[model samples]
Structure formats: C-alpha cells, structure tokens
Target chain A: MPSVKENTIVTTAAAVELRGLRKSYGEVVALANLDLSIEPGELIALLGPSGCGKTTALRTLAGFETTDEGKVLVDGDDITRLPANKRDMGMVFQAYSLFPNMTVLDNVSFGLRIRKANSAERTRRATELLELVGLPEHAARFPHQLSGGQQQRIALARALAIQPRVLLLDEPLSALDALVRVQLRDEIRRVQTELGITTLFVTHDQSEALSIADRVGVMYQGKLEQLAAPAELYSRPATAFVAEFVGTMNRLPGLMNGGTVTVAGRSLPVDGTAPASGSEVDVLVRPEAITLRPAEDGGGLIIATTFLGSVTRVRARLADGIEVSADLPSHQASALTAGTHVTLELDEQPVLVAAPLPR
Target chain B: MAQPVTARLGRGAAWAAFAAYFLVPMGASIYFTLFDRDNHFSATPYTGLFQASGFVPALQMSVEMGVLTVVVLLALLLPAMVTIQLSMPRLRPIVETLCTMPLVIPPIAFVAGIIALQTRLSDADPYGPLSQLVNNQLMQTGLPLLLVFSYVVLALPFAYRALDAGLRLLPLRTLVDAARGLGASWPTVLLRVIMPNLRTAILNAAILTLALVLGEFTLATLLGFTPFPVWIVTSGGDHAQQSTAASIVSLLVTWGGLLILSVFGDRRRTA
Candidate 1:
C-alpha cells in the first residue's frame, strides 16, 4: 500500500455538513429534514434499507438533487444552490458510468480534459491514478474489456482525477460478485484513508457499512436513527431498530426489575436506558452473548445446527416457545444436534431492554 | 449437435418462404432488365440507361436531395430528442406521436395540402412583399427545397424509432450526469459525450432518411420535380427495359449503402 503522501491531494480534508435536508415527490417524502456532520478526513457510511433517504442525502450533497429546504456546507462554504458540475465533489454511482467511447486512460483524464489540462499533464495524472487503482496496464483498454470490479476501480480513479474536496460513493460495489465486493470494499477504505478525503458512502448492506465506515449512521424512514462507531453500533445500538438492523439481535420476553432485565430466569444488567421496573419488555441479546450447556433434563431443545466454518450457529427453542440462536466455537457445538436437550444461559453482559411491540 | 427432424423441416420451410418472398421478385427484375426484344440476352438496355436524356441529372438531384434531407433531419431531430430526453422527458410521447403523424397522412394528401398552400400564396397580390418573394424566379427554381422538407417529415418516424431505441440501450441519464458532473457544459456533454456514444443510432437514422428520400416518388412527381424514381417511371413510358435496368441499379445502391452502414455500425460498437 502507498503511503498517505504518495497520492494525497489535500493535506487537510474538508469537513462536510448537511443540515435540514428535506425533499419530496408529490405526496412521498424521500428525505425528511435529515442532518449529518462529518469531521475532516472521516469516512461516514449512511446505512439503511431501500428508500430510506440515504441516497437522497448523498445526491443532495453531490448537487445532483436539489433539496426542497436544506444547506450543504463543505469547509464552511454553502454549496446548496451550486450545480453538480461546480460542486468540486467526486461521485461514483452504482453503475460503472465510465464513458464507453473513451479508453480507460481517457476516462480517468476526462475531468482534467474538461478543466483544460494539457495533453501531457492529463496523461501524467491519468497514469498516476491508474497506478493508484492498480490498473496501470489496462489504461489503454476501453471499459467494455474490463470486468465489473476493474471498471469500478477505474471509475474511482476517474472521480479522484480532479482531486475533489470530498468523495461520495453511492453503493459503488453493490453490482459486483461477493468476492470482488469484499476485495474492492477493502481497497476503497485503504484509498480513502491514504488520501484523507472526507467521504460519505451510502449503502443498504449493513456489513459493508459496518466494516468500512469510521461511523455508520443507520437511517430509517428518512431519518438517522443512530450514528456511532462499528463496535459501538453493534455492541450498544441507540435504538431497537439499529440493534435489529446492524446484526442479529434475539428478542426475548423479559421482565424489567429496577435497572435489570430478567431473561430465562437470569437477571442481566441493562445498558443505556432501561425500561420501567415491573413492566414487560423485549430484551435484545446478541447471538454470541448466549451460552449453552448440555443437561440430562434441560428445558431448551436444539432445533438446528449450522456450521459456519469457524463458528457453529445453534438454534434452540426454549420451554416458553421463544427461539434463540447462539454462535459458539465449532468444537463447542460439535456434539450438539437437533433434539438435544440444553440449558440456555445469558452471559454476564449489558443487554438492551425495550417496550414490547404493541399487538 | 444434430438437429431434430421437425426443426430441420421448419427451417427448410422458412428458407423456401424467404426465397419465394424476396429472391423471386429480385430475380424477375434482373431477368427482365437483362432480356431484350425477341428474348435475346443483351447489355444494351443496362448500358443505354445512362444515355437516356435527363437520367444523369435526375440521379444527381436525387442524391443531392437524399444527402440534404439526411442533414436536415439530423440537425432538427438529434438535438431536439436529446434535449427532450435529458430535460423534458414528459414530452417524449407527445414528440413521438407528432413525428409518427407523417406516417398516417398519405403522401398524396400531404402533397395536395402543400400545393394548395402554394397556390393560395401564388395568387395573392403581386405588389405584396410576401407574394412577390414567393413568386420570384429563385423560389421557383428552388422549388425542390420543398421536397427536402417533406422528405424530412416522411423520414421522422424511422429516424425517431432508431434513435429512441439506441438511447434506450444506453445509460443516457447517467452518462449525461457524469459528464456534467465533470464540468462539461451542455453542448460538450451532447456532442463530445452523448453523440459519440450514439454513433450507431445516428448512422441508422441517417441511412433510413437517405433510403426514404431516394426511394420516394409520389410527392416528388406530384410536386413537379424530377427525382430518380420519377425519372425511372417516366423513362418506362418510352423505354420499359431501360426503366427496369435503372430500377435494378437503384436497388443495388440502396442495398450496398445499407450494408456498408451496418458494417460501419458494428465496427464502431466493437471499437
């Protein structure tokens, strides 16, 4: 990997601020007063399901969509009304978007050509970008000759050619196969960090966002439900939606007593805000947080076991008819099979307690 | 793999149908053009077509009009369609409907409307400036310019369909947005970015327009113009063999032009 100084365009990255961004089409509200702030050189991923306003916010910041009411500030300058061409922001769409008529080298140098850079300078910068993207040998080839991964890499290089102040990636790797998606996702993170350019990545893939972003902002119904670091978002999600969306969270009926929630006859301390005492609540627990012990007359029945390489996932139906899954070391779950009797025990950890859904 | 018996039979039947529909008529035309009086095969009719009076001039006029009509059609439709696609997409169906209107209006009816309008303008007061200009010698001499305009209308449906289908195959909105995002102006986006990508579509539209103009006869003859098709029909009055020979030559030219265009289109797409 190249050092930060090798291809860094800006010594200090720009800070981006999106405030009160609201957009609607007829009676449908795409974005409802969404606000977000990014520190300089930080990569923030707006993670959500489809139609969650994650893309709308990114487009508004890129100047592709005009917000009905909002302000987009980069480095303290308002660029809300600026046309997309003048925004000086690099964007990679879900599609390749590489100009089909041009070679890979020409596609990378397109922005420079539009900026009136001389031919020699264009070639030099374009060559440098191709090298950065690890496609220096394929520069002479047109887009059609390249694979989906290579095309997206070239697209990233092309967007970075102009050295824009900010980088906006809209699900840039969603179109690729699974293996390529992971490889390119890591490469993008490396490139972004090396350049230290503030970036906003919008994606519906929770794992992609969690694994790459400095902060993952979970969006739901045109609003940011929670924004935190990956570990923090996973370990301590601010809301039930975030907890359910980021990773698998088992919802088990529990009784809240004071600051603790009793689940499966075990009282576990609550994290964040706990529900009122003596009120029924749904306790959310991570799969890995649950442990199983075989017993001659246990109340839990192992419904199924799935081998996941390093870890084995065991699904158990409790005596109360609630199903919960547990991920244990393969060796630990090797003897457990369907119909095995086991006692489910909660690990001593902070669990979230929320009001049960209204029937 | 060996073909199934039923599939082979179906394929054979299709080939026989194709030969009967296309090859038979083409062979008859060639045979008629080659054979002369007393059933003697001779090249005189084919060679004598060039010697016929007004034949060369009519051919030249038709070629010129074909090229002009293609140029005019492209100039008017390309930008208009691109603009509508990029900015006012809601107007696309309306524009398509209007372009196809020429297909529903018969050529004879359209020519009658044009002649009626011309006669009304011609009979206006001579001292009136518009009437004087309309009756001028230059206007009378350039009456064939009206044929170019009418040809453009006639070619609209084919041109629009070709270009529209081509646009559908492309990520047009993304291309435009990418170009504009790279700081390209609208004209630069259209010409440098959009048009180059649409090479095959533009070629198809131009070929369609050229073919339509070259083969058109009714409007040209009724409007008192002597294009190639009209000349072929007129020559048949006194020389039937020569007319068939000219028709065969025109058919070859049209087929050759289309073949070259398709080859060029394929090469560009691969390139």
Candidate 2:
C-alpha cells in the first residue's frame, strides 16, 4: 500500500567528527579541546546548561564558529576551513528561521532553487518533503500563518529537502508549548530515522535528550563530562556532575569501602568506579530505587507526598536530619500520611558514590 | 473598559488640536493656490510651474539623486548592519554610535566640512593618479552624482533606523545560517533571503532618503548647483504664487509616494 519512494533513502550516511575544538570569546572559553564523533545514521544529543558549550560545539560542526585549534571531519574530509555555505549540511535553528517573504512551499524549495533544480523537480522534492512532515496542505501559506509547531515542521522539511549529508538541530523545540514540543520532537526523530541522516541535536533539556537521542553527551564548564547511551548515562554516570545533572539524585551520607557503599545499615555495590576504601562519601541514589515500609520504631517521618500520574514521590526526614525523596507506586503511597513514621530500604541496584563535600 | 465622559472629551480635544495644527495651514495653502487676486477660481499657480525655466530638469535631477542616494544607502548600510549583527556583535555599540553620528552633527557644519574637502580635493596634484581620478572623473560629474554620496551621509540616520528596526524584528543570524546551510552562497542569501525579507525596511529607508534629498537645499545651493529645492527658492523670488503651489505639490507628492511605497511593500510581502 505504500509508495515506491517510501522505502529508499534520500540522505547518505555521514560520519561526523569534531576533534580538539578550542574556541574562546575574550577571557571566556566557550569550547575547550572538545571532541565528539557521531557514527553514520546516528543521532547524538549534546546536553548541558545555558553556558555549557553544547550549542557552541554544534555551531562549530555547522562551520559557524571558527575554532582556534580543531578539525571538523565529515566522512574523512577536513572541513574546518570550508565556508558554511559550501559544507552542504542542513541546520534547523532555534528561532523562527523561516524567511517571512517566502511561502511555505518556497521555503522548502529554497535549497533546491539555489542548486538550480528545475521547477518540476524542485516542486516534486519540496512536495515530497512537505508530505514527509505531514503538511502538504499548508504549502501555499506563509510561515507567519502557521502555528509555531507547524512552522518548525516546515523548517524540518526545508532542512531535509536538500538531502544533506548531516543534519544539525539547535534546540529547535525550546520555544514551543510543552505538549507541542514533545509531539514535534517525536516527529523530528521519526523523520531523521526514516531518512537515515546523521544528526546532532543540541539542548539544555535533559529529558528531551534522554527521550530521543541514541547517545547523550553531557557537557559542563566548556568540557565534555560524559557521553553514553541514555540508560547507561542515567544508571551509571561517569562523573558526579553527569550523575546529578541528568536526573534527580539523592545524596545520602555513607561510608565507602572497595566495591560498596553502606547507607542506612545496608551496603550496596557501587555502580561506577568505586572510591578509595574506608573513605567518607556521599552515596547517590535515584528516587525510584528506595522502598518504604511502616515501622513502629522507624527513624524516618513522611513529610510530604506528591502524585505524578502512576507514581508518587514521598519526601521523608531521617533521624540524622537529612531529607530523602522516594518514588513509590501511587496506589501504595496513598495510604501514607504526613504524621506516619516509615522505614526506608534500597533496591539491590548498584549505587554511585562521590566524595563528601564541605558543609 | 470604557473611558469616562470627561476623559473622552479631553482625548477629543487633544485630537482636535493635532488635527488643526496639521490641517489648517494645508487648507490655507489649498485656498491660496486655487484662487486669483479677484477672488475667482484659477489654476495658474499649478500651471505656471510647467512654464518655469529649468523646473523639469531640476525635478529630474532631484529624483535621480534621490534614487541614487537610496541605492548607495542600501548598498552601504545593509551589509554593514548584517555583518555587525551576525558576526561581530561586539562592535554593535561602536557601529551604532558611528551610524547615528549624523544626528548630533548640524547640517551646516557637515556641509562646511564637505566644502572644505571639495576645495582641498579640487586643488590636489601631489597625490598623483588618485587625486587626478578624484579631480578629473569625480569633480567633473556636476552636482547630481556628487550630491548622492553626501546625501547618503545625511540620510544615514533615518535609513539606518529603518533598517535596524526591521533587522531587529528578524532572527538575522539564524536566517542567514539556515540559508547558508541549505547551500546558498553569500550573494544568494543576501539577495534572496535577507533582501526579500527586508522589503519593508528597504522601502521605508528609500522613502526617507527620497524625502531628504528632494527637500534638501543648503548643500545644493552652497555647492553652486540648483537641485529641486534650490531651483524652487531661486525661481520663487520672482513667482510668489507658484512658489507656494510648488511647496504644497512637493509635500503632497512626497506623501503620495510614501503611501504607495507602504502599500507596495505590505501587499507584496503578504501576497
């Protein structure tokens, strides 16, 4: 029932590598000796905070920023010296980047028009991209007439219409409504996968990176903290920054020994590289790994409970005056009240531990 | 919320004041142009403009200079503005200070500086070919072409303001990057994307340049050339009635031209 062109790939797979990129603005370093490689047809999301250099890395790859010392290689071609227009890449920008004067159809066909594609061919490819993004009916409309989500969809179509070797997305969904953002992010992933294009998506939103990217690269202070699969990055962070930034981590005071950290009378195996033996450390635990139970002699008291659809997060204060939050099934947490005393237990998952910080 | 009756009356009075200030002199001029000394209707003031010597040529020269000045303004300011916004944003404050500098300088002082430069260049022989090129090629072009370059400076504040406001409305760097990533060369991006998107700004700036050039008199008169305004004053010393008609016609034509340009920019952009 599908068309003949649906199964064929339009964009060729490209291996993108950024090696030793070093950029600075006066005294501030935006990127410092940064290196990243994306395999053919893979989606890599660079995740970080506002000044973390993730967007700078993406812009460097797109040839927008001239690195003080680095090489940008696409399919083994050193393109660090190449101009952006000659790089033959596609970039979906963060803002409403559609040309205001051009119609949606014209915007999509812009690349084709620049390449001197004839009318019929340009229209065919543009129409194909529009249909791919599911907006064939809005081609005649201007960008201002479409909703923010729709305009971004057209932007995506325009990026892909040229069959670019690698696609660069610079926080393309940060301005949209929450519901629309999720929807558009899913569509972007779907279309990128369907075309088998190598993509680098940059964002400060950890959830967005975790949900769509094949591998997430966490950046901090102009340096790469860690790069790994979403589950691995979440479950076994290489650095304490990555561990704390990706998701909520409850740091409980615990003692570290070779392969384990003991917290609340229980010793759990360390998830990542274990710290020195017999050292004072702060053990990291996810909210979901904590189990709760009612006990007459319990040293913990439930302070608050927040419902999050199928699950609930319960905040409790320990005998040591440390607060810990546990994610429990909403059905079971409904029975617990603020005045109740509860005992906490850890699921057998390996825990990450960091050095104790000065109070 | 509805305004109170007293507040409404106050607003109405303010509007009446502005309307009276704008329309009263215009009404008097219209009455003067349409009547003769005998208190009967006549079109001589309007018709006599055609009979004036060098009227058409002076008007033609002003239009030409206006168009050329606008062309130069766009060619000079747009690239500088885009480059500042996209590449070297740190230079923005400095560039803005430089561009809006004409506003602080009086026209008389600016024209005096130009006259000094012209006098110096006219007698230059030690600089060799450069001086020869300036003295022979440029100085010989008469007033129409020489005035364009000076008018561009005087018109910079207005034109730059228009273009800067328009560029502010756009995510200029993003649009340029998007275009370049799509395989558009620099000229293609400028002509196709940035320029088309800037139609309203271009039109607005062009109109401002035209208005300035068509109404400017000091520089043209001091330079010993008779552009439209200079010709209007020189010829008006003898023909009092037609001078009033000429001033009114210039105002009306500038308004009409600006309206047409606004409509053209808006309609074409939306269409």
Candidate 3:
C-alpha cells in the first residue's frame, strides 16, 4: 500500500484559484464571474443540475475551454492562456474515455510514453497505479473486456498516472450502476485521500457530492449559490436555491417578526439572514426536524405513508391545504397509516427563512 | 417440437432464392471454364491463361493500380476526414455529399470529363509552367494515373461510410483531448492512438477501394488503358475459355481476400 503521508511529502500538490471566470455563448451565459479558490490536497465537488455551468467551470479549469474573462492560477502561476496539453492537468470524463485499443497497462502508461519516459520506468509507475486502483491483475486486459466499473477504475488510474498538479473528474460515476457507483465512489475518495492531490470533481448527484467532497459548492444559474462543508451545506444553506437543491426542503408560509418566523402556530428563531420585521417569508423545514404524533384533535391528516427501510415517511395535509412530509422511525411509524390524524410540531433548532415569492 | 409446414416452406424458399442468387452463376462460370468442347471436364482453360498474350501484364497493372488507389485514397481521405471532424464539423454534410457525388455520375460521363480535362491541359501553351508540367515525361508514361484518380473517386462513398461509422463509435473529441492532455502532439495522437483504434475501418476501406479498382472496366476501356477488366473483355472475343477461367479466379481471389480481412478484424484478443 502507498502511504498517504509519504506521497504528500514527495509532491506538494498545487493550489487552484479561479478568479472571475466568465463564459458565454452568444446571448446565453454559462459561467458568470465565478470565483473560487481550492487549497492544496483538498477535494472540492461542484454540484448542480444539468446546464448549470458546473461542467463549464470544470472544463475552463482543465484548459479545454477559454474563459471569456478570468485568470486561472495554479500555485500562483497564471495558466489562463495555456493550451490543454501544457496545463499538466489530468481529467477523467463521464464516458469511459479509456483508449479502447490499448491494454490496461498501456492506457495507464500513455502519458509517460508521451513524456518520453523509458520503458522500465513507465511500466513500474503504471504497475504501481494499477495496484493503487486495485486492478493490478488486469494490466494485460483491453478496455472492452472489462466491466463498466472496472473500465472507469482503469480510466481513473490512467488519469492519476501523469501526476497531475490538479485532477478533474467530470461525473465519472454517473454511468455506473447504483451498487457499483457507491462502491466506486468510496474507492475514488480513498485513492484521492491516499494521493493527497488537489481535485475538482463536478457532479449533479447531491448525495455523491455530499458523501465524497471536503467542501460542496452548490451552483444555480451559472453562479455558485453556496460553498460550504457537507454538514454545514445540508443543515445551514445560505440561499433558498441551495436549500431546495441540496435536499428535500418543505416550504411553509410564515410571517417574519423581528428575528423570528412564525410557522404552524409556533415561533422559531431564524438562522441566516432574515427579511425585515412584519414581512411574509417562506420558512424552510427539513423532514426529520418535524415531529408528529397521533391526536384526536390534530390539525393535519396523514394522507400517505411510505416505508423506506430504516425510516417511514408520512405525508400530512394541514388545515390550510398545505402538505408536508415527516420521517419517523419505522417501528414508531407502524401505527401512523394513511387517513390517521396527526399533530405536527417543529424542533427548537434555528431554521432558514427566505423572502416570499412574488405574487 | 417440429416446425410448422408453412414455416418450413418459407425457410426452403429463402434457401432456394439464396442458392439461385449465388450458386447458379458460380457453377455456370466453373462449368464453362473447366469443360472442353467434348462436354468432358478438363483443366485446359486454366492452363491456357498462362499462354494468353497481355494477360499477365494487364493483371499486374490492375494489381498495382489497386494497391496505389488504396494507398492514395487512405492518405487523402483519413486526414481530411479527421481534420473536418475535429475542427470544422459544420462542413461534414457538405463533405459527405461531395464524396457521394461520384455515385450519381455514370462511369462513362466521368471518364468523358477526365478525357476532356486531360485534352484541354495537354493542348495548352507549351511554354507555360502548367503546360510544361503536364507535358513532362512522367505524365506521358502509359501508367494510367488518370485511372487511379478515377478509382479513388469511385471508392470514396465506401471509404467515407466505413471511416464515418468508426469515428461515430468513438468519442473523437474526448479522445483527442485526453491524448493532448497527456502531452502527446497531434501527429502522435493521430498515429499512435486514433489509427490503432480504427484498424477495422481502415481495412474495410482499403479492401473496398481495391475491389473497386480491380473490377472497374468502363473508365479503363474508354481511356484505352488495358487494365485487368479491359484485358478480360478483349480476351473474351478470342479465347473465351481462358477469359471465363480468369474471371472465376479473380472472383474467388477477391472473395477470399475479403474473408481473410474480416477474420483478422474479428479476432480481437481477450484477457
């Protein structure tokens, strides 16, 4: 096994900085003055829906696309005008971009060959990378002979073979099946940590980003809406878009008075920026934060119940015609079937509140 | 379980149609070539091929032309197609249309156009550089360079489709970018990476070009070039037996070559 500390000592990975990156196609903007800085040896995941500029940002950093306005710096060296071949960045695409004609070892050693490394050194390094990716025995196999997950692993090994200062992965696990996706996701994180390479991973799956990234950057409409650690991003979203995009958020009509918002006849202190007093706002609540109990005089009706292994989700319709879902322990939710009356209460945790939508 | 009566009849009819389409003509050709006037099978016609005048030279000329056509066609088309696909994808439809235009033009009309162009160029002022270049000894040789050019045009559609299909199966842009990112130059990427992956397509294109060159008659005949097909036709008027025998041999050779190519193409190594 390659020691993470030893690898880190051998090569100090470079920090990546993107300053005011802006790109557009005719009238439509893809990236709008996005600025971000990633630390050395840190893994940052840019998460967004399709066409949200996450891919555009990653490609710009990879030097595949020229930003209309921006400066890309690696270790404080300006690489904005550099061509892709000279940038020294390794990329693993969503599709299995392994050269189909070459065997696994050849694919991994392609960069070394391009760099004019002799045969013995290239083979040694390629063998080491294959072993790192847990496919040492598959060196002689062609790409088509491997399964999808195995092919992707080989692609990853090939990308890392170049010792790129910064690694870019564009939805590498999106093509994999669910079980293999999760398994490969953990495998990628393990390899990344073991190498201590600065990586920028672009993906649309929220759980994938949250589970793998040191910091998750939620993007919306060509802008970074919120960039925070996974736990902070999930619990305390900085914007309404981030709150809704990251996880299941139930929007409840509330009135903001002073620093508190009133929802479901209960007052709760707001966490982030709140609207002025006496303004209507939408209070964002997570399902697990809402507690439910069976009551004869309940204000909500349990309209549906779904068993989700460890937790059962119950959808309840309030008297005001607003429906909300609450997750409960499977054993406790056994009695809360559809058509049962249930009273709802909010926990005392600080909640995020957004300004009311335009009428 | 036994097959239904109607199903068996349908299968039998299909087999009969296949046999009629393929075996009958082949058997007749063989019969004509092998049997002498006494109606007894003999190999005299096959032996007569060696004694026929101009047979060996014409056959050699056609083989050389076929090989040259394949080389020139690949050299011209592959780079042009790769460049177009990489940088100028908007021009793909126009290029494809232009490549298939030869199929629309009859062979006679195409040869007439080439003859007219050659005449116009040859009749130009002798002192002019273009005229001097065209009137050179190399151009005056009876090597039928014009036939090779025409064969390349005729083979374009097949070559294009084979290469286009192969390129479509690959993520060309991504592959190029990946190679470039790994510090490989454009030439390196094309030769080492892209060309290896396109082995089957290249083989198919080359075989198609070779077949087109070998069997083409109108252009060669009208141009007064005695290539293999022209030789075969001219010999048919005098030595019918040798001509039929040569045709059968050529047909089998082409089919055998294609079969071998396909086998090589399919024999991809497993882990």
Candidate 4:
C-alpha cells in the first residue's frame, strides 16, 4: 500500500488528470484529443455506446495503453511514461478476471505478497477484504468454484486489496444478469463510498450510469458531449445528441416562423432564440414533457397507446400525418384506444429547439 | 452368473498366447544363464566376473558416464526449450524440427561421420588445437562429453515435447501480467511463476532422459563411450550369470527412476 501524508485533503484531491489525450489504431481514431479531469473520492461514470473511447480513457489512466499525445498526471505527478504496475491503480475487468489457480485469499493478497507484506498481516487484511465484499466464508474456494457474481466480487476485493488511489472499472457488471447486476452495482457504490476511493466507471447502460454516478459524462464519437450531474444532464441536455442519447426525445421536424416554431401543423411557444424564418429546424420535446387530452373536435387521433404502470404513452397522429408520442399520468389518462380522436396540449414552456439538417 | 463355454475357452487361449509372448523369453534367459549344460557354472568360462579384470572398471565407468549424461542433458535442454518458447514464438517450428532431428538420423551414421572426422584430424596433427582439445579433455574424460552428447541426441524429442506441452498448458500471459502488475521484474516472474509451473515437465523429461541414457547402446558403442547398456552387453557375452544379474540391476534402477518421476510429476499449472 502507498503511504499518504496525514495533512493532505483527501476528498478534493485530483487523482487523475488527462490533458489532450489522443490515441489511434492505424486508420481508426479511438480517442481524438480527449481531456478529462477527475477528482478524488468522486465516482464518475463514463457512459457511451460501443467504440466511443470510454474503455480507451480508462486504460490510459491505468497506464495499460500509451497516449499518442498529451500527458496523464496522477496525484499531482505526470505518469505518462510509467508502466501499469507502478501506477498503483486498481482495475476490475469486464470479465471477472480472477486468477483461477489461486484461492480467494491468495488472489486478494497477491499485491500485498508482491510488496512483501508479512504473512499474518497479509492474511488478516485479505480476510477482512473478503468479508467487506460479503464473501467472508468463500476465502478458501478457488475462482472456478464460485459463481459469476461471486467471482466478480472477489475480483473487486482483489483490486481493492492494494488500496490504490484510483479504482478503474471497465463495465464490471456487464457480464452478470439483471438482478445480480443491480445487487452488485449497489454493493460497488457502497464500497466505493466506504473506502472513499476515486473511481471511474465505464458503462453503456444509461440507467446504470444515471443511478450510480455522482456525475456522468456522456460520450459520443470520441468526444464528451456533456459532463454534469445526472439530474442536470437529463433535465437540460447540452446538445441534440445528448438529449436523444441520454433519454427518449421525440424530435419534430419543424419550421421557425419569427419567434415561434410550427410543427405537426401546430404552433408551439418557444423559450429560446428561434432560427431564421422558413429555416428548417427540429423541435425536441420529451414524452413526459408533453400532455394529451381528449379533443373530439380536434384534428389529431391517438394511433397507439402503451400502458407502463405509472404512466401511459400515447402516440397521436396529427392532421398532416406526423406521429407525436406523449406521456400521460395513469390516473389522469383518458380511456382512449388506438385511432381515437385526441389533442396535445403544450403544457410546459422551456422546450428544447434545434436546427434541422440540409435535405 | 452362468458363463458360456466358448467365451471361457477363448479367454484361456488368449491367456496362453499372452503367457507365451512375455514369459517364454524370461524362462529361456533364466534357463540359459543358470542351468545351461554347455557351461555348467564352470569357473573357467566365468573369467569375466573376476573384479581384477576390465569388468568392474567398465561397470563403474558406465554408471558414472550415464549419470553425468542425464544431468547435462537436462541442464542444457530445460533452459533452451524455455528460452526458445518465450523469446521466439514464430520460430517454434524451426526449433521443434531441430529438437526432433536426432530421431530421424541413424545413430550409427552420425557416429560414423564423427569418428571419420576425429580420425582424420587425429592423423593430420594430433598435437593441433582441435585434436589436443578433443583428446586431452573430451576423449580422456572417460568419454564423458561423448556420452552426454549421445544422451542429448536421444533425449531431445522427449524433453522438447514435454516442455512444449507444459508451455501450452501454462497461463503465461495471465501469470506474466499478474507478476508485472504487482511490480515484479522479469527475472522474478520467470523464477517464481515460470520455473515453478514447469516443474512437472522438467521431472518427466529427466526421467525420460535417464531411461534413454541407461538403455542407449548404439551411440555409446560407436563413440567408444562406456554407457550402462554397452557395459551390460560386454558383461553379458562374457558370463551368463553375471550378465543376468546386471540386467536385473539395470531393470531395478530404471523402474526406481520411473517410480520417482511418477510420484512427483503430477502437477497442475497455476496462474
């Protein structure tokens, strides 16, 4: 284990600092000038689809991959040229990569053994770590003897055994089933908080990122679209891609006339600057942000209805044959079947508006 | 349960055939050595058994040379196999071909060439550097180098295959990565993980080398080296009783070595 000064502030410490990080493989650019700064004692989730450079960033920080350009500073020191072993960073692989030949205790104490810790102290620490991961009785079993979830937990404990400054997780829960994933996610969060270790979690699941991260960075096309608190990101997306990727957004192709937008043959009030008149633009509205009401005299009809326990989603077709999806509270939802006459009400202001692309 | 008569008759015939295959040779050899009417245990024909002659010296020389051959073969082959596998994965076929080359070359043909060269050089200038080195050190060391070279040639196939199988079974990448991630240097990783994981391979190859060393006679005879098999052959033709005794002794030694190898050679590689 590394020794830290007693007078240093632990929480506000910046453990990982990446500046102009760039990596590419032949003709494909994996990471194009990625810059990210992570603070100590904070769990930041890197959420993106496959090939979005999330894993590349984590590997760079762990010193597993070399940066084509720029530097990686850890604990206020540049580690651009250091090897992975000397980086003192704990990493949990996507596959529960436990050493299959060793028992759980030995796997957990591998780092300590390499550091030449005493036998008694190493055993005691390893046992405590196993107990911390809720596997106190499984210390004697080999990795193959355990289930997938148990193996992941053991991998986690083995990573934490070294007490590293930063914990890097590469989709650690992706291999487990849904129920075990949720269970292990909570346990990982709890352990992270208990240990107060700076961790970078990479995942493709939006809900998992939104639920577990203190602040989530939404990545797309090798660049971060937005990095903010989860609530802020969901409530106010920074870009059109962020809005569509982070949550469900019904983008309505519309025309900007003066300060108001016309979409689906209906005029909606805009809260932001409207594009030039007659310019093609897209009007973004979330499902829950729009409201539906029974309007028999109106020109729209409900084409489909999906009941989701708490809220009912209604897909209504306008007079111009464009479909608009809106969510209604279950209690306030009308008993409107498919192909029933209805009307949408613009019940909320501050609607997100974006410019449309050229045809 | 009731048995069929035809099956019983077939089984009895199979047993008779098996008995004739293995037991007849032992019976004939024992009969020839102990109760042959031609020699009748006469002291005159048993002149080779006298310790004052060349028999004891040859026996001692063969035992010493066989042990040295086994040791040198193992020492040279283990590290060579490991280094070739670790450093040059692409050259594996070439290395394997070289390791197995001795199997295809006839021992007599190989030793014939060696003897031809040695005689040519010895006649040209016995006091030259090459002749002096060979005669002074290699030949005069009781043919130790020749015996060791013979053992290596005979044992290469077994050693290479065993170590190659071990290398395949070992989780080399995981072990190397684990050691490196724990701040261990390359030498430490090789010593701690690589060597220990190859224990079974080394033991199996050692036992195989020992067997080949003890049983090899063609190469030893061609090279004029005193290996156990050559000694046994010389002793056998001299006196039937002493030759049977030496055969039993060699058989016991081979069996003991195999027993030790089997006992300790069962190992599972760990990452």
TM-score of each: 0.90, 0.94, 0.92, 0.71
Best TM-score among the predictions, by candidate number: 2
Tens-digit lDDT track for model 2 on B175-245?
89899989898889899999998989889899889999999998888877778898889977887678888
Q: What does the TM-score come to for chain B in model 1?
A: 0.92
Give stretches of model 1 more than 4 Å off. Answer: A1-12, A272-276, B1-52, B83-95, B119-140, B239-241
- Per-residue lDDT of A31-125 in model 2, one digit per residue for the tens? 99998999999999999999989998988888888899989999999999999888888889889899988999999999999999999999988
The CAPRI category of model 1 is medium
Kindly provide the TM-score of model 3 when superposed on the true structure, using C-alpha atoms.
0.92
What tens digits encode model 3's per-residue C-alpha lDDT throughout B1-271?
9999999999999999999999998998899888887899889888878778998889988998899898899889998999999889999999999999999999889988988877666775644677657545324334667778778899999999999988887788888888888878878989988888888899989998888889999988887789889989999998898898999889999999999988888785232
lDDT of 1 by residue, B1-271 (tens): 9999999999999999988999899899889878765788988778887788989889988898889898889889988998898789999999999999999998889999988866766776654777757545323433367788889999999999999988988898888878877788888898888889989999989988888888898988888888999999998998898898898888998999889988987887798
lDDT of 1 by residue, A181-224 (tens): 99999999988988888899999999999999999999998889
lDDT-better candidate, 2 vs 4 = 2
**Candidate 1 share of real interface contacts:** 0.55
Full-model lDDT for every candidate? 0.89, 0.88, 0.88, 0.76
Off by over 4 Å in 4: A1-14, A256-261, A265-285, A290-308, A312-328, A331-359, B1-179, B190-271
Order the numbered candidates by TM-score, best leading. Answer: 2, 3, 1, 4
Error of 2 at B165 (Å): 1.6
Chain A TM-score (model 1): 0.96
Residue lDDT tens for model 4, A209-230:
9999999998887778889989
Report the poorest 10 consecutive residues by lDDT, candidate 3 chain A: A3-12
Lowest summed lDDT window (length 10), candidate 2 chain A: A1-10
Q: Candidates sorted by DockQ, descending order? A: 2, 1, 3, 4
